[model samples]
Target: MGSVTTSHELFEVRRIAIIGAGPSGLAAAKYLIAEDSYEQLDVYEQQPEVGGVWFYSPEIVGVTPVPHTTPRGPPELPIWPKGSPAPLFSNPMYQHLNTNIPKPLMQYSDQNFDSQSRLFPSRQDVQTYLIKYSQDVRHLIKFFTQVADVHLVSKDGKDHWELTSRSIITEEQKTVEYDAVIVANGHYSVPFIPAVQGIEAFNAAYPSTIIHSKAYRSPDAFKNNKVIVIGSAASGLDIGTQISKVCRKPLLNSVKTSSELKLEQENKEEVPPIAEYLVDERAVRFEDGRIEKDIDAIVYCTGYLYSYPFLKSMEPPIVTNGRRVRDTYEQLFHINHPTLAFTALPQKSIPFPLSEAQAAAIAKVWANKLALPSKLKMIEFEEKRIEELGDGAGFHVLGFPNDARYINFMYDWVKTANDGFAKEPARWGSELVHLRERYQEVRKKFVEAGGQAKTLEELGFEFSLKY
Candidate 1:
């Protein structure tokens, strides 16, 4: 017997499974396909459409505005893969919701948001743009499918792994072992509804009115109703604002009152894997039968969890601090599971660009699997922050450095871009491109806020035109 059954074989991966089909997943598919690395590709999405987290994601569905506000009909469908449908972003959306950030600032920098478009295009416009992006790269995905689990195995007694996926359609499960797996499922899959103390009794009492933020789409259902919104993130705040206009005297920011007055509420149940509880370190409590000023609906805009039900089989535990997927710096590789990687984890603004950049960089070093930043450093950072903050709750947005927020993203984009998989633009071409114009337009606003402005001449710009 020649060395028994040897691990001499090199793994041949024919297909790669990219989860979640949102901006991150779509971008990954675009790069992998455009790179021509794998012969076959599959994209698993829980949503019917291609816009992950945008096409009415479970998190932001509460703020998706009212339905069909467009004067003109929806945009024409883009050219997709034969039998594969066009993106859902092209569908009509509610009118009240406008992009919080301006469109020009939000574009991929390489892609234009149409010159005739509004500064802050409606949610519908963003969706349409996403749909167009998917159609342009439609050859790359298999939609309406989902990944139930992914495991790293020593198949054939080798260093390679097999990937197992389950389709939501036909209730069929399939396995396609890949040399690599990209978990692009994103974060919004599991809605983190804070189950308060009386929540059980309340639902037992008012089952019809108690709704998670995920199910909410427009105010039409909430009109004239007394609403009580929970949490204070952008999602929660936005819902409260919307309901205030439509509902009668919405109790805005009532949940935040505990923290505002430094009143600590005791023994509230915490949501696991995410250290923070539904109630803040400071919480709101009332006597029996007094449910916060006679509110009819309690909209739980409590946010999302870092849910990877697929990773339940993996041992050694992936420890997460609050909303963050911790122990992994920059939220990429794992300290334990080296063969697997996840995308769509946002450390800060415009998470897609940064995530795409990081993934592409890792792909170059794909063979160097299990390469993690030192565990000691990771442990040190986490402990230090846990000590400083006293409680690990919500996003640590400014958690990194001054330059890291943008630089990390720009760096990741270079990998596939350099290989011509994605367009490699010389300049970052972010807001910096419009810096001078922006400065000229808003210098007054900054000065009004007791700030000083440096002119182009002073800031080292030689201008041709007279001021």
Candidate 2:
């Protein structure tokens, strides 16, 4: 970590580098561009175009199920034969996926989805929307560039970042220096499959049968097969529901919570977490002493780890157990090194708007228009957060009302930091909060009605001034 004893030298940000051309990275670029103080702003993306994970390819990344034993750092990009096109990074977007959050709440503040688009737009719709949103700063993005390492360096007694990025296709590398860095690369890259008892042997018995949600492309592969879907989160439920239509009757849904056990869906039955795998019997033993035999596939819909193999150089590491980012203040700025910040770290929240809010705050602070609390104060905030939320993934889990409050808080924070020239940040008013509160219900109604509703009003969700 770089040491800064004075405030004047700490916030002297001019040339900034943003990693990832995803929604969060694009938002960061827009806000940073709005601030005329930055001398240079570069957005690095490994993919050929924008839209991060939403930029889907039929090709899926190979699964690495063990989290603890897995090597740290970004996975090495696959090399193609000379003159061949480089393969794209595998994304979690499946064929039949749609936004769980409605377009009204999911969109960035400055843009709206096409009027003809559904209330919960499809995967391709979002990819197109993000590409369109990135038009203004397209010239600033360096596509096909993968940042391999980011380290803190000292020059002229001031702290700066030395970044090394490699070309995914050419296998060429380049190193550059910047005043600050924003790690907006997103966290869904590395899939997190929990260590289950006898899963390795199970995989040996049924090769390619145990898989993570990242590798899932279509439900057709699971058709007429006995399937067990693990984890009951958004992806788990969505994937399980999609498979139930084609899989064997009563698709087994494994969950860790009693609340999720009550999830009622036709052709799907909630089951306890897996206890052991009976390799010889080709069966799974549940925690409740029930064994389900002849299981064809076990899809771990478990979430991803927060990985930044590039930040391996940082002292007092940021990532641990791939669960949550540590030493972050308000889950954005680094406490010891305030200039180093992150966006879209919170899970179970509206991503697009949340990215904008975080980018706005980071931009304001980096531009010297907004002041951050002292290092001691920032450290205290994180300590309090860990005490309240505990550690691991829960440290960054901002669900429902917390997500609403966070965006609004960023709005107010940036408003106070405004120098009369900054663009207005996204403000979550009572109506937006109300809509967000009932997002699941609205999405459920839409899905139940065949997902044909083109607008919230069409789904009977009206925009009201009153809560």
Instruction: Using TM-score, give the best candidate's number.
Output: 2
**Which segments of model 1 are wrong by more than 4 Å?**
1-15, 34-40, 57-96, 156-159, 255-291, 319-322, 367-406, 409-467
Local accuracy of candidate 1 as per-residue lDDT tens digits, 59-112: 222232212111121111222334544323222223355554444335553465
TM-score, structure 2 vs. true: 0.95
| Candidate 2 ranges with C-alpha deviation above 4 Å | 5-10, 66-71, 79-86, 258-264, 465-467
lDDT of each: 0.49, 0.84
TM-score of each model, in listed order? 0.67, 0.95
Structural RMSD, model 1: 10.7
Tens-digit per-residue lDDT, 374-435, candidate 2: 77788899999889989877998989899999998888888887485376667888899999
**Worst 10 contiguous positions by lDDT, candidate 2:** 66-75
Best by lDDT: 2
